[model samples]
Target chain A: MNPLRPIGAAFLRFLEATGRLSEFTAVAVSHCVRPPFYFRLLLRQMIEIGYYSLPVVGLTTLFTGMVLALQSYTGFSRFSAQGALPYVVVLSMTRELAPVLAGLMVAGRIGAAMAAEIGTMRVTEQIDALATLSTNPHKYLIAPRLIAGLTMLPLLVLVGDVIGVFGGYVISIYKLGFNPGIYLKSTWQHLEFMDVFSGVVKAAVFGFIVALMGCYNGYHSRGGAQGVGAATTNAVVSASIMILISNYIITELFFAK
Target chain B: MSAPSNPVPKIRIRNLCKRFGSNVVLDGVDLDIATGESVVVIGGSGSGKSVLLKCILGLLEPDDGIIEVDGLSAIGLGAGEREAVNRKFGMLFQSAALFDSLKVWENVAFGLIQGGRMDRIQAREIAFAKLADVGLKAEVGELWPAELSGGMKKRVGLARAIATTPEIVFFDEPTTGLDPIMSDVINDLIAKCVRELGATALSITHDMASARKISDRIAMLYKGRIVWNGPTAEIDRSGNDYVDQFIHGRAEGPIRMEVRAP
Candidate 1:
């Protein structure tokens, strides 16, 4: 095998995929703006993407906050810096952990579900049926999911932020023998509006990325059951990686001084 | 089955071609369906009958061709124009393609509610009426498609196909998976629905019995082209070796099954 040839082919495939993705995204985003909103479908997707995911996201963020406080306390106490634990916990939860962790979790749950569901629909010719019925699949299927993802994730992350901070508070006050009043006061004092706002903004973008990847991979999936399996894997894996990549990018946008 | 003098075909396909990479599905195929006519394209699996059906419905873009439906050119239609052309069509997929998420009635009423701009109550009533015409009960309409039997699913699909009384209907291998008795039942219902609506019908099937039952005319596709086309009554005597081989299900004729290399 020629080294350059494989690299060239892989590069060409990447470019081709990027072009297809751009086209799909353009059409889907355009459909999101148009009329015939299909409000009922949007509502259903909201429940699926947001409401049903509350418990899981809540648990993930809560546990993460607890772990963060524990780790920070252990690290800070060695340098007589235990006073900074609450500040660090709250800042991390609001600015980075809440959005990133929650985004990764939703990417796993919603992204995989969307891919598997739509991939099965593709294999079954339901997408073709939708087209034949004078319905644009982008409008009917992908647009609703995108809207739900965009709107609901910020809501999820907001809840995640609150739960995570509360988790840190619980661990700091009860488990670490810190005063509850001091922990609460310290957590609130340094958690700025910008920190939370940037995370929420990141949530919106991450949500869009998850749904977009799910819809894109599922929409383009072919072959059959194995193909659907591949799409599901690709959706979750890609959404998670994109969330990580974009988290850093958005953080730089927000906090790079 | 001869065309009436000066008849304008409701659906006209000329020099239609579609390809996937190196594999050609439809290659310069030509056919016409007269108004209110039932034409079944018969071919083995992978012979591209489904691709031909998809091209006519505007579901698959042909690499090249002219498809005129009801005197409107179908090729290269903008999204709006494509939707306009698609509104004239109703398709029944092999698995009935029922929206398992929707109730039986919602599946039946989809086109009316979505395409015809009809309200739910009105659409449901029409849906029920169509369901009844296809021998389904109102109670059955309340149930989800998953709750229905295979035969019931096909009936619901037929109800959906005629829900809006489309100008043309497509059945994609309508009886492929059903048992013999159920297949016959579906074939009968499809014929009745197409006849009652006076809609032009283009169906793809490999099942000869179903084809003969539902179609007035049969077109045989082989190697991405229409090999022979004539009335169903004359299919047995078409005298073309390929048609004779296909219709008789004999392996000893001119058609050779391509066994892929190991």
Candidate 2:
């Protein structure tokens, strides 16, 4: 009944969970690098995580860029700095908004699906069946998804970057009465390669985080339907939080003086 | 020489123990199955029956035990060796546990294509043959597991279990939710498949009818220990109170159900 005992017990539980997650991640990564890779499974997961996610990532970033342009215009006009509109739109879309927003959106869609599917498999004993059938669940189930996330998120974000900047361009030229050629020129002038590179790097890390959380939570899920539901919720929440946290760390590493 | 004085058992388990925190599940379980023998461990729900099967299957490690398959120790084997050992094993889960993402044929062919590395076309043919063996039509193999009836799913699961032609097959509560006629059908099919393959068979169930039908021998698990072991023909006369209570489905017995008033 000691108050300090409860805190110590909770701390121990946290440390145990962190250790288990780290081991799971290490094993998953090791399997990814090992032989007998399931190319078909990898292709299927890529299509699921990347290609299927295009429309949502596209629409989200496009609208984000549009709203960002309007907000930047309102703020810049106060100081008579409206010429910075294109620069702001392009830089923000490439460096931060596109990757983060696409990440969060994809985390909601793909992360939840992976967790629910794997968790259901766990609860149903299909994962144990996989083991009995001489297939390693980590290799057969987890590694492909992990590989897909690492590769596909950056690609999705890159597409998002272009679409988002285009959204801004459309808004500035049509709504703000700016010349199209001038706006395009200003966007190109302000965008450094490092800006896009850093974002793509962040996107890759975010993708890995999303997939890792999904697989880790799902793989360890026990009990039944409610356990799977909990796993799915945890997957999305953890992935979203990790994305935001890693985004800042990566941004700081790239941009900090 | 005809044979060694003591031929090694296909599967030999001794002093098996497992505990989840303070709740002990399996407590010193001992069993031996000769090659090509069919043995069923009968127990009520939550009696660590499934845990016993999982431990032998290497899905769950027992805190203390010796599990030997074909005279070789199975505990703590390396991944490659474990996979090699497990390749000879197939299982039919209580729920059938089909991969919902895959078609029925794919589910059946999974062990073949994944474990045996047999090409899909070859595996599909073998899958169809196994499905036919279980009294399923070839057309049934194309449908999703979700589209299947409860009985059909069990049949498909039986088909998957026998598809690899495994040396040992484990069935986990094979007839749990099926109707009587369907249950008997699955039971007969299980017996037929195990006999045809000449495989050692192990199953865990509370279904006395299923135990009698498919098992050559029956072992009754009570309080995580094998309370009785004998031929299925002798189960009715075992003279064990637990067996008597279990077989008769009686409420009054030495074994109490822990039911509390709400």
Candidate 3:
């Protein structure tokens, strides 16, 4: 009884936490659709979530694209299939690396930021002050972030797609001795609209998940400074993992055949 | 002075009960405040004074109670109803709780712009006027909350509380982190603000000086109930041992604080 007691309690706690997260997500999303929208707050968050996140997301996907071109050349050279390099770089960048890498990078940046900001507010009782001011915290704090995440990620993914493909072009033409015109031609010829579309869709979903986890962890944070630190770490880690998991699920949905 | 034949009080609580896990915070407490009156609830840390204020503000729900505000039931209100009730209230939290993201004037103007749906230009004008009332200059309103000193933050918080001229105002530890001089300044501001606006005021403080200065009547909360309540002039001679020990700040008394770990 003693040996199993701890495990049973741990499992129960996990279930309870999961239930709370689900309920929190539901309330946050519901508030996002309701009236009394704070458009100024929404615009502020768009600048915070999308524009400010560009440099990090751009750099990550660009480097990943460049590295993919170089590595694919090295591996395919052995099989005498080095002609597939451009196709591989374009397809992978649009379908996988652009959205997933961008998601993870933004999760690391925005997730930690949202958690720290909201967590500090929680500890300082600013959230309670909002309640007293006749404002709903869900509508004021969570909804704008959710809307920004939903609307901005697709744009971010599109920008990532361009930068990533350009990166692959730069490496292939300048470093790999491939002709610039042919490389660009092959990349464009092989790329379909669905490839970019799917990644953008994934970006939107990843954005929602990232912002939701950030807000949820921060809103529920208590204690003080240490609690805010834990919430920040939890926001980044959980958002990154959820991005990976959802990427696979989304990819399977798009191209399971 | 509260007679059975009198009209309804501005605020009333009957048999309020709130428990947190196994630790009971409030237990069957009843109290009343008349219109335009100042009432202060005094208690030490963990005595649930904050919890009582949160319950009244609709930030926390009491397990069971009847809370009447302005002669209307304020318990278990729906979201729209709760917001409606909350329109009449303003709170100054322990740390001032100013929104760090906003400029001082924006923080003060938040209730007017967000809740009242007033135009931003008009709200900013009101916010600056309120800031001036709290002895802050118009330039001070442009700075963010982080730039302000502790005392300045409390003043800004006070300005925000009275920005809309709310009918009811709550001061939660209004002088918690200030020096003696600053604490006295805040108490004076609170008294002046409540009086000038003719607002009903309720405050919770462990600072005896704050209680004595701001409140017309004082109540001491012990073990989640009102142990003593009377006019501020009578606090020193209230004769209740708990009140006696608290007012005098003596370590020995009927209140044996649980100094050890739970």
Candidate 4:
């Protein structure tokens, strides 16, 4: 009857569940190497997870870029450093803001949806149906989503970089009375391919983590409706946390020098 | 072990035991299903009937057992080997479990196109034909799973299960959530499909009417073990108290429900 007993039990259960997940992942990797690869399903998931996610990422990046430009200009102008506006804007957008914002946006959108969809399938026994029909659900479901995440995230990051830079350009030239040519020149001169590449690479890794967490939580979900909801919540929260953690690690790796 | 000489049994399980934690679901269970035979396993809710089927299908691993299909050991098969074993199976899920994102025909044609690597046009043609076989119109094939009625969804599920004309077919609780008339219709369709395909079938259901209608042999699962098994015609005279208590839906019996104080 102790109150701490339930909390202790829950903690133990969580550890046990994590252990199971590690085992499932090992099995999934092994299955992936064996053939009868479902290329069509992978292509279909790529379209759903990647192509469909472009618009949302693009919109978020554009608005974010514009706002960052405005905010940086406001902050820098107070110190009479308005000349450094373009350098700061492009550097910030490409190196940190674009990938992080894009990762978070996708975590909310694609991560939640993937979890819910896979969770519903688990409850409905569609995943079981796949197994009974000689189809490996991991191969058919997880592999495609993973491939899509790895492939599409880089593209989404590229799009985000462009939109974010363009947003800064608009705010600088129209709102802040800067010369468009000079602004563009300063932005290009300050930004390096390595910065863009690193951000894109982070986006890809973040995307993979998001989809993996979503699919993993949902695929192993039990009970029913409430379980599906829990899976979705866990997927979004976990993916967001992983994104933040990985972002820091990648930053150190890329900019340590 | 000596392999059967002439016709191979489609599925065979020996000394199967499954325990979830300390709670046992299947205990020393053994079953054999011959080619072209229809076997129905019947039991009360929580009777481990589904667990037995899942073990045979290799979806759940048994704690200690051997499961063979077409003389191939299914228990420890690798992924490629498991896929080969699974290619011989078609299953109708209890909830239909249709993919909402796909059109009806696409769902039906999923295995044929995706697993079998058949062309889309050919798969669609086969899917439409299978739909027609289940008395569903061609137009139903174009609609999504969400758009279909419960009965229609079950029919579409039936079509998808049989899309590849698998050698063995499993029906899990085929009549659980349907009107009596609709259940009868599904049973009839099941019977017809089994006959036409000459496929071995293993179905689990609590519906005695369905068991009687579709099965040549009936097995009754009780307390993690099959207590009674024989030809379907002998079910009425089995004279087993557990079977009687179950078939009549009586509250007073050896089988007791676990009631806990809240």
Task: Give stretches of model 2 more than 4 Å off.
Answer: B1-6
Over A1-257, each residue of candidate 2 has an lDDT whose tens digit, in order, gives 88899899999999999999999999999999998999999999999999999999999999999999999999999999999999999899999999999899989999999999999999999999899999999999999999999999999999999999999988998999999999999999988999999999999999999999999999989899999999999999999999999998999999999
lDDT of model 2 at residue A62?
94
Please write out the lDDT profile of model 4 over residues B1-262, one tens digit for every residue. 1122346677888888999999999988888888778999999888898888788777888899889898888897776788788889898988898988789999999889777889999999999999999999999999989999888898999899888999888999998899999999999999998888878889999999999999999888988888888888888889888888887888899878777769
Error of 1 at A196 (Å): 0.5
Q: What DockQ results for candidate 1?
A: 0.77
Q: Pick the candidate with the highest lDDT.
A: 2
Give lDDT tens digits, candidate 1, residues B71-172: 778887888788888898988988888886899999999988877779999999999999899888789989998899888988898888889888789998
**Which has the higher TM-score value, candidate number 3 or candidate number 4?**
3
Model 2 has fnat of 0.86
The TM-scores of chain A alone, one per candidate, are 0.98, 0.99, 0.98, 0.92
DockQ of each: 0.77, 0.90, 0.81, 0.72
Candidate 2 DockQ vs. native: 0.90
Candidate 4 at residue B92, lDDT?
90
Share of native interface contacts recovered by each model: 0.75, 0.86, 0.80, 0.75
Interface C-alpha RMSD per candidate, 1 decimal: 0.9, 0.6, 0.6, 1.2
lDDT of 3 by residue, B154-192 (tens): 999999999988989999999998999999989989998
**Per-residue C-alpha lDDT of model 4 across residues A1-257, encoded as one tens digit per residue:** 99999999999999998898788667666655667676777788778767888898889989988998899988998999998988887888788888898889888998899999999999998888888766779888887787788788888888888898999899899999999889888888888999898998898899888888889989988889999999999999999999999999999999998
Task: Give a tens-digit lDDT track for model 1, residues A67-186.
Answer: 999999999999999999989988898889989988998999999999998998898888888888888889999999999999999999999999999998899988999998888888
- CAPRI quality of model 4: medium
